[model samples]
Every structure is written in C-alpha cells, then in structure tokens.
Target: MSKLLNDDVKEMLTNILKDMVDEVYVKVYVDTLTCETCTETHQLMDEISELSDKIHYDLVETHGDKTVGDKYGITMYPTMVVLDKNQEDKGIRFNGIPAGHEINSLLAALVDMSGKPLDLDDATIEAIKAIDTETNIKVFITLSCPHCPGAVTKAHRIAMLNPYVKAEMVEAQTFHEFSAKYNVSSVPKIVINDTHDFVGNQPMEVFLDTIREAA
Candidate 1:
C-alpha cells in the first residue's frame, strides 16, 4: 500500500501536467495494483490528475471489480490512449513515458483538424510571399510507427521553415486503400503533388533541396 500513493512520484506528475495547454486530452489506465509497476502507475495517475483540468485519467485495477480494461482490450499493466475531441482515436498508444514533443504534435494535429480556422498573421503572409513557392508533398505515415515520426518531422520542418514548400502526413494505416492506390509499401513515402514519388528517410537539408526543386 505504501507504493500505491507515492508522494515523490505524484509531485513530479503534478509538475508535468501544469505545463499542459488548452488543447490536450490525456487518458491513463492502471490495471492491477498488486505489483510495483502498477503502484508506480497509480503514482503517475496522481500526477496527471493534478497537472491540469484538461487532463482526464481513469484508473483501473484487475483485482478490483472493474471492467474498464476489458472494454478497451487492455491486458497490460499500463496503457494510454489519446483521443481527439470528436472522440476519434488518433491511434497514438503509449506503454511508457511519452516525449513532450510527440504529445504536443498530436494535440496540434487534432486542433488543426477540429474545424478551427487558422488565421494567418502578417508575418505568415510575408513569409509566404518571400518563399514564392509552388508544390505540395503528401507523405503517408502511421502515427504509432517510430520510423514514421522522423520522416513526418523532417517534412514538417521543411514546410514551416520554407514557405515555398508544403507537406502533409497522411495516415497510411487508416487509409490502406489510398496507400495501395499510391503503392506505398513503406511508412514515409513522399508523393510530390501526386506526380513524383520517393521512399525512405532523407536528412533535413536534403529534404529542403528536394522540395525546392519540386517547387
């Protein structure tokens, strides 16, 4: 029982949750509080609960009379499922501590797709004009695939840092038919405006040069 509510771990979680913004939905699951792992899991949940009002977590224990785990097909000790506001699963699953950047990226993607209009500031307008660009690169990838993140990151960085280039990360697993139509057998396949195609990873500098040429 001593491990069930570890003050030190709980405090750390509190600090992490405090940094959350208005657009994050975090769900934590704790199954079976008999083992050390389960105890630590509860501690983390305590931290998450104290983090922010937006952070929602549900605690589950196999020893207790609860069916949360069964509903979600969770037979593991700790599982986290992040869902968008529409209650749609973004397919991001975590078995351990997730990186802040990864979590923030998911939140940003959800916000962008939630019918929220993006207002372009004057700086954005200036940047767009400066690039004088013309090209859209659609990258097919899966959210949970480790390799897919790096590829999407490279493509996204190029788009943000260069106005002339635009990139989109399409969910390949969810859109298997589209992936087959595009002949995407890999995680980070790039299609230049549906005309040119390439596979595998490329460094940031190389990606910039390639996008420039495409534009």
Candidate 2:
C-alpha cells in the first residue's frame, strides 16, 4: 500500500512538531475485524512518531490484550489514548482516525500533551478546575470538515484541564452507528453527557456554559 502521508505533508508535520517540549506516549488500540481505517491509523501513528523523537506510540491489539483497554474504559476500535510525560490517561483520546482537517486536533494534542498548556486566563483555568461533576464530552466530526478540528481541540483542552471531564473525538463517517445514535447530521456536534449538545466551533465560554449545564 502507498504511504498514508506523502513526503510534503510529512515534512510539514515534522516542522510543526518541532514545537514539542517533552515526550508524548500514544497508546493506540487496533480492532482489525471491524475498523476499516485501523491500518491507516496505525500507519499514521508510525509516520508521526518517526517525525519527532518526542512523540512515541505503541499498538495494542484489542482482541488479545485488555490491560490498557480495561484501565481506560475504551471499547471502540481505532481509539488512541494520549498520555503526557507522566504517562497517565488524562482523558485525552480520539475515537477514530484523525485525518484530513482533524489532524489539527492530533497535532495540538501532541504539543500540549508534551508540555505546553492551554492558553486560557487564570480565572477561566480556575473555573475549569472548580467543576466537580463528571462530564463526558463527545465531539462528533468528519475528516473533511474545516471547522470540526477547533471543536475537537476545545473539548480536549477542557478535558486536559479538568480531571472530572473526559472528551473523545468521534469520527462521524467511520462510526456511523454511534453518530446516528446521537442524531449527528452536522460535522462538529458537541455532545455532553449524552444530554446537552450544540453544534459548530463555539467559543471556549460557550463550551464551559454547556458543560456547566450538563446533568
């Protein structure tokens, strides 16, 4: 098969990845029987890891190994749980292939998880920390959508800041059944706790407001 990332894109990603400060450990769960993009996802991780020494990735065959899956509560195929230098699952995850424009989220995660923190005001950071309720954010997206990456990145940023919250980027086209369950017709649909949801690349305040309103 041809390489998932061509040389030009690889060079661009390599240059962009030079911003990483520390190392990132990405645990990729592969499901061969059902996931169509599993091969591409694995290849993407390999290509990405090769680009930066600060980034590291390993594959876990879900059918055989259940250690990481059992700990992280991940059941879906082609899921990637990203960890920082601490190697802890701070709920930084992707439920599908982060391709096309969605690669922005992956790149952001790589940088942030490595060392950089989210650029938010002190008050906003405190507000995110003060939220005690457990929240599950699922940002449904498609690979081609231009606006979806921002939404996914916002969700993940919140998750990274708050231990009580966990976010996942669900690729709508690949996981059609899951998207249909949420009635996801749009590209960037932000669903919280299977209840509160809104569409588009809403601002950080709006995301906080919706999360606060989630039951």
Candidate 3:
C-alpha cells in the first residue's frame, strides 16, 4: 500500500536518529581527476542528503588528501562510509547501493542496533527467510565499465549467496538494442522484475532494500 520506504519507516528512522547524541558522518572518497563517477556520485549524495538531514557529507579527493585517505584506510573512489559520532570506527559500510528496499532495511537495522544492542529474533529471521523464499529478483549487467564490474560482481555475489537473487550479464556494446529497449542510458542499470529501475551504483544496504521490496 505504501512506497518501499513508507512514512512509518521514515518516522522510525527519524526517532532513532533523533535519539543519537553524536553526528552521523558520510565521507565520499573520490579521485578528482581520474574518477569518472565523481560528478554523478556527488549528485547522488546530494539526493540522499535531501532525503534525510542526519547525514554530514565530506568530499575528499584521493590525490589531494593522502593523510585523510590513510586515516580512513580508503583505497577506492566512490566509497561511502557511515561513521558514528566519534568518527573513529565504521558503523555501516555499503560497497554499493543494493536497492531502495535494502537501504531501508539497513536503516532499520542501524536504528534497532543503536536503540537496543541485539540481533533480530528467530521469528524475525524466519519471516526474513520466508520473504527470501517467496521473492525473486534479478539484475542484468555488463563487465566493461569500471563501475559496471563492481555492480555486476555485487549482484552476482548476492544472487549466489541468496536463493531469491539472480543476476545476468548483457554485453552493453553487443546488446545495445536490448539495453536501449530497457532505457538503460548508462552502465549497471538494475531492473527489478521488469517493473522498477534505477541507475548507477548504490550502497549495499540500498541495493538489498531494493531487492527486498521487489521480492
């Protein structure tokens, strides 16, 4: 009845978010010159911050700040790390956006973890397992784009690890017609059940959330 990320979930996030005494820091690690995804990555972060005001964004260019990268142990551009108030340790790290549904799930997990230090109960696990059993999600991707490979690998890895997940590769240049038909204007355009779609690489939690919703 509601969108994948509903008002209730948003409210829950806001509540837990309000309870936090420390600031949540989001660091965007990128290479200013060589990184092809820098511009779009900034745009995506902009969108994310617009959705929630709890995030503090800091753009760090790889070449410009060696000490900063060393401090964070960042070796990859377009890497997003969620740090707690202290900024000493990493709380949640997403390699790529899994999906909208997956992001919401991770947010819920973060909130739950922050509010109460524990894991999901058996019943909840069973429900999650049931959801996995009933849901099927697939992603068609390519291997050429630097970003494409990581996304493709993540999708495949997730599919291999989860029964309901599936990912296929379509050579972008070879299958240009099919790609065009899907309105895939860029690399790694994930399509869910021929219904939902989003472009670019996403955080892992986000990707999982998207798959969860599709399921």
Candidate 4:
C-alpha cells in the first residue's frame, strides 16, 4: 500500500511520540467487506506504528474474529482501540478513520496511554475521579469538523484519568445508523450511556456535570 501519511506528518509524529515512556498498543478492528476506508485506516495505523518503537498495533478482522470484536464491543468498521502497557482497555476508541482534525484526538489518546499525565485542570480531574458509577461516553463526529477534536480530546482525557469512564469517538459519516439513532445533526454530539445526550463543544466541567447527572 502507498503511504497514507506524508513525510512531514511522519516527522511530526516522530517528534510527538518522543515523549512516550511506556508501550502503547493500538488494536484496529476492520471489516473489509462493508467498510470503504478500512484499507486506508489499516495503512494509516501501519505508518503511525513505524514512527515510534513504543507503538505497536494488531489488525483484527471484525467478522472473521468475532470474539475480539465482541470483547471490545465493536459494531462499526475501522475501529481503533488504544491500550495501555498492560494491554488494558482505557475506554479510548476511534470508531472510524482518524484522519483530518480527529488525528489530534488519536495522538492525544496514544500519549495518555503511554502513562503521560494529561494537561487537564485539577478541578476537572477531581470531578472525574468523584464519579462512582461506570460512565460510557460516545462522541459522534465528522472528520471535517474542526471543533470535534476538542470534544474528543476532552472525553478521552477524562477517561484516561478515571477508571470509571470509557469514552469513544464515533465518526458520524461512517456510522450512519448510529447517527440516525442518536439524532445527530451536528458534530461533537455527546451521548452518555446511550440515554442522556447533548450537542456542541462542551467544557470539561459541563461534561463532568452531565455525566454525574446521567449516572
């Protein structure tokens, strides 16, 4: 396959990954039969894994290996799960191709999984830690939306800090069924536990408050 990431991007990724102190595993679940961008997603992950020795990835066919997909609760194509050194699922999921603005979200997830402390505010961290119940956050987005990255990063960082939370970034265009089910009309639409949902780019406190109320 041709390079999905350019030379400049590769160099940038190398610099960004230099801060990684621990191993980060990327598990990519792909379905070639139904997903149009599965090939590109695989190639993109392959290019990224080459940028750093700390990064490794496994490619699993969603239909061919249903057990792994079921374990991760993967229902969409080209889903990527970023795991920690122990191969623990930190609830960081990319439900479609992590290109365009969403690339930043993917990078941030990798860095967090490498045991680096996130730059979130202490108040936000405390708020997330106070939650006692398991929270599942799903942020629906499109690759073209500039504001979606902030939403995704906020959710992923919260999940990184708190064990009770699992956050996923679902590409709206790729998962039309989910988009319809969630009544998504714009980017950065956040759904908590498949019940409470809201739209727009929300602040960290607002996100925590929403989760607290939902839980």
lDDT of model 2 at residue 19?
89
As for lDDT, the candidate ahead, 3 or 4, is: 4
Regions more than 4 Å wrong, model 1: 1-131
In candidate 4, stretches whose alpha carbon ends up further than 4 angstroms from where it belongs are 63-65
Clashes of each: 1, 0, 21, 0
Best by lDDT: 2
**Range of the 10 consecutive residues with the lowest summed lDDT in candidate 2:** 61-70
- Poorest 10 consecutive residues of model 4 by lDDT? 61-70
- lDDT by residue for model 3 (1-215), tens: 22434567557556655643435666777676755556555665555454456566787676655566776555445555555545533223333332333444334323332333234355534443353533333333443454654454445344434445434434444345656778877766777666666667775555666666775
- Reference-based TM-score of each model: 0.43, 0.96, 0.41, 0.95
lDDT of 2: 0.89
Tens-place lDDT per residue, model 1, 40-125, is 54565555445456655555556753576665444344555454455444433443322332333333333332323333456543
> Which candidate has the highest TM-score of all?
2
lDDT of 2 at 55: 90
Cα lDDT tens digits for candidate 2, 56-98? 8889877645465887888787999999887988898899999
Q: What is the lDDT of residue 152 in candidate 1?
A: 55
Predicted structure 3: lDDT: 0.51
